[model samples]
Target: MNRKKKIKQILKQKAKKANDKLNPKRKPRYVSKAERARQEQQVEDQ
Candidate 1:
């Protein structure tokens, strides 16, 4: 019973850590439409 409680505590701690890691909002790098078009044109030309 004590071992089960300990395992539950460890599992809960791990779940909390994983949730913290997964929930944070990440900012993406901004790309301009002109730059994207230029890249696509270069690829097509090649």
Candidate 2:
């Protein structure tokens, strides 16, 4: 039971990895809140 579930999960992960390698998704870069505040401050100062 437990062994079967674990095997299934591993196979699922392998399939997902292969699919992603073939068709990768584009992810936007993340901007932290502190960085955002700094940018706003710079704009206001200028």
Q: Please give, for residues 1-46, the per-residue lDDT of candidate 1 as tens digits.
A: 9999999999999999999899975887787999999999999999
* lDDT measured at residue 26 in model 2 versus the true structure, 0 to 100: 93
Which candidate ranks first by TM-score, i.e. highest? 2
Candidate 2: residue 14 lDDT (0-100): 100
Candidates' TM-scores? 0.49, 0.54
Model 2: runs farther than 4 Å from truth?
27-46
Evaluate all candidate structures by whole-model CA lDDT and list the values in order: 0.94, 0.96
- Which window of 10 residues has the lowest lDDT sum in candidate 1? 22-31
Model 1, residue 36: displacement in angstroms?
Answer: 38
Task: Name the best candidate (by lDDT).
Answer: 2
Per-residue lDDT tens digits for candidate 2, residues 1-46, read 9999999999999999999899967986899999999999999999
Distance from true location, Cα of 8 in model 2, Å: 0.2
